[model samples]
Target: MTDTKTVLITGGSRGLGRNMALKIANKGLNVIITYHTNKAAADNVVAEIIKTGVNAKAFQLDTSNTASFDAFFTDVEAYLKSINKTHFDYLVNNAGTGIYVPFTETTEAQFDDMMNIHFKGVYFLTQKALNLMNDNGGIINISSGLARFTFPNSSAYASMKGAIETFTKYVAKELGARKINANVVAPGAIATEFGNGENKTNETKRGLVANVTALGRVGEAEDIGGIVAFLCTEDAKWINGQRIEASGGCML
Candidate 1:
């Protein structure tokens, strides 16, 4: 097999996902990114990655809908086969939307949305993706610092992240026999359009996040992509089943 590796990431159209795609491509890895709806944005990222002379493609995916996974993998497999690659090297489960509703006010539908997108989808997606991933490949799951610290109005969302963190450890243990590593990258408050631009547009919230962070500022998308990309590289092979919080020491 060719030594060049391929990494597939979900929600790679914009924000941190876009940054991760570019950085992973910087490591000379071919990239396959799944976008929920924004084909224009996904295409833009693909264009950027291809400029480095590496292979890149974008496919539409509704990560919360488990029924769509079979078709998604079918398309992805066809693309990989066309490139003469039977298996991918990395799977980054990073696609999700945010909803900020207080605990008491959070409804069953809201809670289920969180579970479907953040926990259940990731669980089964990785389960199915495992068959197509090569031995010694790595799985990087995007979690949130909210899983560790407390925050109002985040009960539903954060609870699911907590589940994912636990799920990742089990995956690392079970997949160890295959030499496949699974880990979580929990990011702190980042200045992005995520969570309805919670930290990006809210100056008051931004100030609060900066005060608590040891780095004395809210994290940028750039600060995190390299961390995720590094985990996909050779140097990170020894790291497994750990939650690496790239939160700049928030709530310390």
Candidate 2:
């Protein structure tokens, strides 16, 4: 079996997840990334990681569908066997989408979607992953700046992230006996394709975010990846059950 550490990242086909996968791979960790759809894009990411001289693979997953998880893990187990490994060393719960409907206009379906994807999905996915995670492994749960500060149309999204933040602490506490660390990374408005690329393409929105951020700019995917990679390293071994906000001091 291979002795190198490996990480499993959800929604790693593009955006921040993709950046995390690449950065972690650069740190000499093998990567297993999940894509909801777009196998071509996922393959491209795997290829890019391979270029870094690290083993990488892409698997399909719908993070919102809990029923598919058991079957998905079977696939993961088979892949792990092929790699001569029994478990991965880190799990990054980064798969999710943004919903921008105003609180007054948000419907039950929107709320359910947010809850399923952001909170429920992450909770159960991590629960199931524990079987495949080695002792001393770490989990990084992706959250958002809106959880800490209000955003007019982000009520549902932000609330779900808040739930994730709290849930992460419990995970850390409960899993401490296993030496598993669970932490959350709350990123600010990053310039990615999330929410239809509003922060990246909408000039007015970009300016508004920049004005509120102490760094005077919107965050980029690159800005958050290395932090996640760092958390999986030995240097961050003692940082457990904490919410690390990577927002460039937004709304401060």
Candidate 3:
């Protein structure tokens, strides 16, 4: 019943997810973020958003575990009731991890991990989320530039992202009748703690990425959050089933 819009972001304890949560909150939307293990970090993000004069909370979620999603949504529903809202307005499937093993060296466990977290998790999570999402809402699926362009030792990770891209298109198509828009945002090499902070800490890797990017520098988390926030706005109502790569023209 509340007039304020709400967004649910997964893996928002840190990294790009954290940035997106904060940016979305700054746009005057309430935020519910999910964290895998870092409760303190998630709580900190919530506190920061509260200071921004928006209602924000963090919940624990293991996106890779499908069995837990039902319970997760139950908690979400209770929280929504407490806030005097029936459904959320946006869903950002952003929880993920990186594995740098080469295709030949990639173990079955690693591949399955990638599939569970990146593809399957996003797939079913979105499916279940529909019941709790408002009509005319939006879904933003996070992808990676490696999905479009090849990269050494990233075959497994990139393949899952490619699957998400295709899945997001189908979501957009099928959900159009409900007035919900689905889109994917693929970020270029970003200097975040993702992948163990290699891009942020390794000067050689940063330099290499900078050389290939048209912007002449590796992307920061700040570079990507606004794009996700924009998609949730009324201005992006017509933009559906699209893949918007925030890569600074890498490999172009």
TM-score, every prediction: 0.99, 0.99, 0.98
Q: How far is 140's C-alpha from truth in model 2 (Å)? A: 0.3
Candidate 3 per-residue lDDT over residues 1-252, each given as its tens digit? 279999999999999998998999999999999999999999999999999998988999999999999999999999999999989999999999998888899999999999999999999999999999999999999999999887688999999999999999999999999999999999999999898887799898788888988989999999999999999899999999999999999989
Give the Cα lDDT of each candidate.
0.94, 0.94, 0.94
Per-residue lDDT over 94-210 for candidate 2, one digit per residue giving the tens place of the 0 to 100 score: 999997898899999999999999999999999999999999999999999998998679999999999999999999999999999999999999999998888899998899989
TM match of model 1 to true structure? 0.99
Model 1 per-residue lDDT tens digits across residues 1-252: 367899999999999999999999999999999999899999999999999878999999999999999999999999999889899999999999888899989999999999999999999999889879999999999999999997678999999999999999999999999999999999999898988999799898889889888989999999899999999998999999999999999998
**Which parts of model 3 have CA positions greater than 4 angstroms off?**
none
Model 2 Cα shift for residue 25 (angstroms):
0.1
Worst-scoring 10-residue span by lDDT in model 3: 147-156
Q: Please list all clashing residue pairs in model 1, or write none if there are none.
A: none
